[model samples]
Target chain A: MDAGLIFYGSAIFLMVMGVFIAITGRHLIKILLGIDVFDTGLNLLIVSFGYINGGTAPIFSKYPNIFKNVVDPVPQALVLTAIVIGVAEMAMGLAIVMQIKEKFGTCNIAKLKELKW
Target chain B: MIRRLIALLVSLYLGYILYSFVYVHFPFGERPLRGVAAHYVENGIKEEGATNIVTSIVTLYRGFDTLGEVTVLFLAATGLGLILAGMKREEEEKPEPTLIMETVTKHLFPLVLLFGSYIFIHGHLTPGGGFPAGVVIATGYFMMFIAQRSFTPSEYLLSATESFAGTLYVIVGLLGLALAFSFLDNVMPLGIPNRVFSAGIIPVIYIIIGFKVGSEMTGILLHLKEA
Candidate 1:
């Protein structure tokens, strides 16, 4: 329970920090850094869900065993998938930033002119 | 100004509606999934001849869903590749990382790759699985890229691995279609549990996925850095 609070609190903090970066940061890289913070927070929340008290590795030995020692692997797997997706998203974001710089000669957020539909 | 005000009002209304509808965490009075999973476990090992129920469900019973998910990834990678293909990294005024990072990354990279491959191979018996292992493997390459100035990965090798893994995945699915009852049907010899060849084609399929995902990840990182 204590861990849950820590996880959720940090998740909220990182998410808010990310929003702040995206909203007010002057540089494009700073915005990407903020997004990474948000992603890390989400990954931490996911890992916390798979947390079991005193849980060990999920390996089985051929005999009777205590089941409480193994936290769920599904969430861990899901986090892995999410992390890859995050990489792809970040890459695309950076790629666009590169293109923007080529076209506009800067990565300043205030200088963006292609914001409209 | 009036348009802005109207848009704000609409957004507020929608936000409130969304807040009311989501994240309540109420009891749904549905049948216990725990019981269902437990019952499935009791009977599944006998029926499927596999100890790991998660592996069984993912590979044997719900194989089609896994295939769809892989295909989704394949599509996403393809889409992103098209968008970012010619994109180049624009590093402004920043000095290269220190000599410590250079020395440490070059020396420690092999160990990291070894650990990642070990995780993928032992995934069926252990907590770590393919996706995480793939990322770890990719990270090893990523670390090399970051530490060294001219250590760009081979795009030809990466694309080949990606295509090979994806094609093998579909081939396995079609084998199930041809010989077995359903798609991705687990027909390979299920060796002794906890052994290297155990879990039949499940581990093989996972390895292929790991290869594809790792290569795609490395390729994306390379493209981003080079772009």
Candidate 2:
């Protein structure tokens, strides 16, 4: 019934799906997609936490004095940074995957176990 | 199938734990934000001269964090370059793009570039900022690469702009240290809020960040293509 509950529930569901994909997927790209999904879920969770019942954005362009019912901007800022970092991490991950494919001639996690400690 | 089932079960358990943790700790949509958030919302506009509270927080209150974030991006780009350095390039014949598509791409590229610059320039006064703008610029270049398959972006130009932007960011931050209180401080006069040139060093930093991110992202995309 509550919107917050629904939002959080969906976020958790996506996170679970992401974890399952990460754990069960064989290919490197699939694992990367899983991580991206997980990142999205985390961002959603953060933005949802900052939500108020009927809060506007924390910008002051429209209503300078509407501070009483504004959503928290901290999470939004942090999420922005996190999203950029996630992209960089994903790019690097894909690059490493390409290298692995070049060297090992495959992208399967099982095949990559040779380098495991 | 068994491995997938086990993974599903583990994920469900982890999800349950996370859900409970969130439910217990953060009562979503119920409580008021306290401490730093409250302070930012209250005094951000006055002090930072940015209507967008999030922008103020990202560039003014916690600018050092943003610097670190940019460094992380730079390192990732460098790492990608290093990893793909040894790959041999093979020259292959590619199909020529249709005249219509080429014309459309040529027309749209400048528009996309303009929009990206607009986003970065008006970051302090608007919702969009440097990161998104940089990605948009990279997208424009990507479209160009696709349309004009033989057209190679000047690597020297991309690197030059990237380095210049990065150095300028640091210099501006250092200016803050020398002139103002601390690192990345708002040393310049905070002009009228909601204007293009307001928000002191915030827009300057964001614009530099935009240039750096755009060039680096384009480089990364180009590198991946080559790889």
Candidate 3:
């Protein structure tokens, strides 16, 4: 019934689903999508960590009780950085995937025997 | 079948661990604003003259991290370029965009660019900042790419903008080191809070970051498209 539990539960559920997709996905693009989902879930979890019961954003334009009511700005800032880095990482991953497809003429992970451990 | 089973087991284990850890340790919404967050919220207005506490923290209090973040983005873009460089270019005839798309893009490009600039320029006061603004600018460019087949963005120009913006950012940091207390320190006079041009170096830094990120992203998109 608690709001915190719902947020955490959904985040965890998404993360688990992402992991499953990443592990089971045969297509390279599917794996990439799975990773993206995982990244989103993690970002959501982090932003949720900064939530106060009824806190507003951490801005001071026209809000009263600035200190008492503002949510944690630190995690929000860190998440901003994280989101950018995630984009960069995704770009790099997709580039690698593109190269793999060009080289092997396939996007299926199961077909890439050389990559198998 | 075996792989799916393994994946299911692994995901189940991960979910169990995460759920248990979060349930036990973090009570989520009840988290009080304390520690560094409390300090920033308390003194952000006086110290940085920025109403947006997150902006102050990102641009001023923890600026070095931002510099590093930008460098990582640069590296990623460069790496993508390198990885895609060797592909042979095949000139395939592409269909022209629909009339509606062209019309909408022609009418919307300038507005999107203006809105992006506004978001970054008012980053210190508003919720949006350099990253989102830069993405918006890149989206505008992407629309241009999609709508106009002849619209080829000059690679040299994008690279030049990215490099110039990156260099300007470092120069601003060096200026801060020389004139102020530390690198990326607020050397400019902090004007009245909650106004445009009030956050001193914060807006300037955000603008530089906006340009840098925008060009870098455009370069990556171009590379991907060409490859």
Candidate 4:
């Protein structure tokens, strides 16, 4: 019922939803979107892992004493790197999809099963 | 129907496992700061002279990792460029931008660029940092693309800026190794905290990262658009 449970619950829900979408989606672009959703959920879970009951941000510009109740900075730093990498990955994935469509003449996963052998 | 049912079952099972794991090990909001995180929160300012602990961690405490991250980003962009090359160029007709869009972009473009620079310049003292600032700068470029169909950014300019920034970043890190204790160390004088130029090498490195990321992202956007 508390904030922690809510954060964890939503993160898990997003992860499950993303997995379902990835499993069931037919289009290549749809599958990519599902993967992005999963990425978002994982990021949410990581940030939440560093959460404290009422901790503030880890900045010390204004309130120096807040470090006593500051949330963990390591996870935040990790998420920062993850987000930039995610953008790069998304761009690469979309580029590959474009190439696939160009060569195969379709974006449907079922139609491009020529390599199933 | 079967695929959907199987997917549902898999998702449900995965969700149950994750939920139980969270419930058992990580009781929400009660994780005490320990080990490295504790040290960072407590002494990060003293060591790095940056008000933003996360910024200090990203650019200084774990700076080597950030260098590797930047290399990965560059590789991804280069790979995308390689993949998109040699495609059959199709001349698709495009419509002109609306009057409102053109006018808004004309007025807003400079402000966005200024804001992005501000973000990266003040990274040590504020919440925003290089990545977000670079994205914002790229967004400005994206807006220009949207407003003008003929707006093709010069490939030379983008690559030049990106390479220059990246090289400068390495040079700064090398300087740190030569002058200070290690690579990417704070060789510059740790100026007054809460100021724009505080945190020694942190702000300089962030500025380099900002330009590098901005140009790289803009190049990616251009490739996707051209493709």
Question: How far is each candidate from the true structure, as Cα RMSD in Å?
Answer: 5.4, 1.6, 1.7, 1.4
Give lDDT: candidate 2, residue B25: 88
- The 10-residue segment of model 2 chain B with minimum total lDDT is B86-95
Best by DockQ: 4
Better candidate number, 2 or 3, judged by lDDT: 3
Tell me chain A's TM-score in each of the predictions.
0.80, 0.91, 0.91, 0.92
lDDT string, candidate 1, A1-117, tens digits = 455456545655565556555555679988898788778777866655555556543344442342534554455545655676676667667767777777788888777767762
Candidate order by TM-score, highest to lowest?
Answer: 4, 3, 2, 1
- Angstrom error of the Cα, residue B28, model 4: value is 0.8
- lDDT of each residue in B146-190, candidate 2, tens digit only: 898776898889989999998999899999999886999999888
Candidate 2's residue-wise lDDT over A66-117, tens digit each?
A: 4577889999999999999999999999998998888888999887768652
In angstroms, give how far residue A30 of model 3 lies from its true place: 1.0
Candidate 4: tens digits of C-alpha lDDT, residues B38-131:
9999888889999999999999999999999999899999999999998766897778789998889989999999999999999998898889
lDDT by residue (tens digit), candidate 1, B1-227: 67545655654454344334322331111213344444444454444544555555555666676666666666666766776666555568667889999999989999998998887777666655566777899899999988888788778989899989889999988987888767787777776665667777778877887788788778777776666
TM-score of each: 0.74, 0.96, 0.96, 0.97
Can you tell me which runs of candidate 4 are displaced by over 4 Å?
Answer: A63-67
Model 3 C-alpha lDDT per residue in residues B75-121, reported as the tens digit of each score: 99999999999887678878879999999999999999999999999
Superposed on the true interface residues, model 4 gives a C-alpha RMSD in angstroms of 1.1
Best by TM-score, which number?
4
All DockQ scores: 0.18, 0.80, 0.80, 0.83
**Candidate 3: tens digits of C-alpha lDDT, residues A14-92:** 8888999998999999998899899888988888888888898999886344646888999899999999999999999
